[model samples]
Target: MPHQPIPPPHRTYARAMRAEATKPENLLWQALRNRQLEGFKFKRQVPLDGYILDFVCFEARLIVEVDGGQHSGAIGDAVRDRHFEAQGFRTLRFWNDEVEKELDAVCRAILHEAEGRIG
Candidate 1:
């Protein structure tokens, strides 16, 4: 029998997060999954650089985060964004309410950012 290596903690955590996605995350995912948004592929609960991103479009180097109230004015988020930026990726964030109330606008913003980055 061949030995199977255990997945890293972050990878395992990411998988867990995918299974336990929030309502806003699920809503946004429906809009982004299967290349539904302008044929751009988006992945949910992706682990990268020791962080678990809510959604990521590698081709576009864009990351979308659906945050709840706990994330408002969070300094950690700023640091995370800077880290991703340094890695040549852009981070986009939306509040839970925003996603629930303005899903169309959220998708539009994501599409626009993806197009710009893809360009």
Candidate 2:
């Protein structure tokens, strides 16, 4: 089992991460923040189970990850996904390039999944 996350430290780290978001992260955040995408609110760099999610829609129980090349075939991600799944959260992963090059499609996919969960 994964260790329980200490909220205070994790929150601090999440804040720092938000401040240093990558270009793709920034682009995706702009599209996901507030109620910009299909009236669903997204919070960036949210900490859960000692992991910071790129974006999350709490109401929809959806976690969106904007991953770079380093994440390809990462076993840690698979473990994290299982952990989130056990917490009744669904994760959607998109490559950084996909977010940068095909942002509209990414947003549409997120909206579609969120709608299924929320509506």
How do all models score by TM-score? 0.93, 0.92
How would you encode candidate 2's per-residue C-alpha lDDT over 1-119 as one tens digit per residue?
A: 45475689898999999999999999999998779997898999988777888899989989999998899999999999998888878999999999999999999999999999976
Which lDDT value does model 2 have at 30? 93
**What lDDT is obtained when candidate 1 is compared to the true structure?**
0.92
RMSD of 2: 2.2
Off by over 4 Å in 2: 1-5
Clashes of 1: 0
Cα lDDT, all candidates = 0.92, 0.91
lDDT of 1 by residue, 1-119 (tens): 22234459878899999999999999999999999999999999988777789999999999999999899899999999998898789999999989999999999999999999977
Worst 10 residues of 2 by lDDT: 1-10
Pairs of residues clashing in candidate 1:
none
